[model samples]
Target: MSSRRSGISEEEINELISKLQSLLPETRRRGSGRASASKLLKETCKYIQSLHQEVDDLSDRLSDLMSTMDNGSAQAEIVRSLLRSS
Candidate 1:
């Protein structure tokens, strides 16, 4: 194949292979070194947990404002009315 591609003789291919081998060490098979599904899932779960906590915190703050509205404060009711209309 090499002989036809570069017009080199079969003898040249053998010589080239030997020369390359002499100059470089033999290559070894590599390990996968890939992340496991559990590792990925744990990271994803952590990210989702942070987002969920943020949403919960925001909901709690909104709930506090909503609770204040029930006390019949005129300014709070106005804000609540505006929020409902929007």
Candidate 2:
């Protein structure tokens, strides 16, 4: 997709909105009615905490990969400089 808002056709947005609206009611019903609000909140909080940790782990891995790339680029530049000096 182009990096322009104008490039986003209405049909695509309507399709996405339709899918989201269809899913929302089912997801909302998961903790409704017989379930106590407190219990539902506690479960949701725990699930979000777990997801947060997973995201943190992935962020750390991405940081390591970026650092490795930066180091490799520096090494390549040094090699190129040495070659030019010779």
In candidate 1, which residue pairs clash?
none
Please report, in order, the local distance difference test score of every candidate based on alpha carbons: 0.61, 0.59
Q: Give the Cα-based TM-score of candidate 1 against the true structure.
A: 0.37
Residues 1-86 of candidate 2 have per-residue lDDT tens digits of 65255777766855654454333443356533333445545655676788899999987985675566655597656755765796
Residue 23's C-alpha lDDT in candidate 2?
39
Give per-residue CA lDDT, model 1, range 12-86, as digits (tens): 866664443333222112223333445444655676688899999987998887776665788787877877997
In model 1, state the lDDT of residue 39.
49
**Backbone clashes under 3 angstroms, per model:** 0, 0
lDDT of 2 at 28: 59
